[model samples]
Target: MNERVTPEPQRRRRRPTKQGIVLSQQLIIDTALRLVGQQGAGALTVRRLGISLGADPSAVYRYFRSTDDLLLAIADELIGRAQQGWQPTGDWRADLRAIGLRIHANYQAHPQAAMLAAHRTTGRTHEIAAVEAILGILRTAGFPGPEAVRIYHAFVDQSLGFAALDAAALALPAAARTADLQVWQASYARLDAATHPHITATAHLLATDMRRSGYPYALDLLLDAAEARLRAAG
Candidate 1:
């Protein structure tokens, strides 16, 4: 009689979300990025994230302590995306140039996220990796430790500063952005030459130039200075 006893059935694990999508830190970050990109940073509340994710808000909290934590993660994720597939070519100036441009371009690609998170200090993986790579380039280029740090500080600040500035413009409502872009042409270009001779003289140039991002030219200037410093150090 004992040999005929039945065995118990095994229970299946519960799925993390109603949509049956598996939860992960990367998936959370990706969803958050998309939300911010589409609806602006103000729309990135935990409840909204949960709705977008088809999960309980508690699930998101399990991965991040708070919204700020998630924002830092998003910022770090942008840094990671910027550096993805990048490798040093051993030409320090060229490498730094490439890294700076890559970071700027990536941030511009997600203007809302850039405007929201560009100024944050994540102390996360991508941020740490970026610092390491930049410092390595400067140090290998013959910069002393302190000089290398100083240069890295300036380099990162310049890149992020321009990113935030450009992103602010990009994040504006389409009509507003168009209005701002036309300021140089519509306002400055019409100024009377008598009282605004200098502005009038260069208004045409400003109309075109101001519409373009100054990041590339500024980045080259920084590289040129770094190259000069390296030469002078020798």
Candidate 2:
């Protein structure tokens, strides 16, 4: 019966004029980080992050062109933190190993993120800082500029490569990972006597010492060799 042009339903009135804090780029990155920390890197997407942040999904696009950009940012941040954690105590070999271990530990701290960033090149400010720091350490250790840069390149390749591999290993299915362990175990268990008497004689020690302990030792040895070469040149 009705002249029911039912008074046009009142438009929803905006609740108030209080200044609302809009999410900024830093906040988005921070939120994305928390999401990665909780759900792993694979779970991070612009839409999911936006959902988590209570924002329009397209908003995240303005901050990151895509997920890879977001990941690279995170990698730079994590690597920067790792660089900050290591205190170089005068010995270049020790300091370099400290850098390597810190990188390994940082990736281990966030396995998924590290995996995504494996071999990623950000050219970020922190990366430049890290290179500068390495060069400084090498120069302090008496490596001439060219030699320092060479060693710096090698060091960075191994540090990030190994860290990425370690992260991937962590992510591997348990059975596959266990199979890898089995291969290592098999190698450790059997050392031929005639061809490798030294290895056979100290198989246990060799296996235990060479596995993870040796990366640092190897790094130190290489640096010592570099030092010897430098001394010879001088």
Highest TM-score: which candidate?
1
User: How high is each candidate's TM-score?
Assistant: 0.92, 0.73
Estimate candidate 1's alpha-carbon lDDT, on a 0 to 1 scale: 0.89
Model 1, span 121-192: residue lDDT tens? 999999999999999999988899999999999999999999999998899999999999888888999999
lDDT of 2 by residue, 38-103 (tens): 787656887677677676666555556667777778878877878875677998877877887788
Query: Which pairs clash in model 1?
Result: none
lDDT of each: 0.89, 0.71
> CA lDDT of 193 in candidate 1?
100
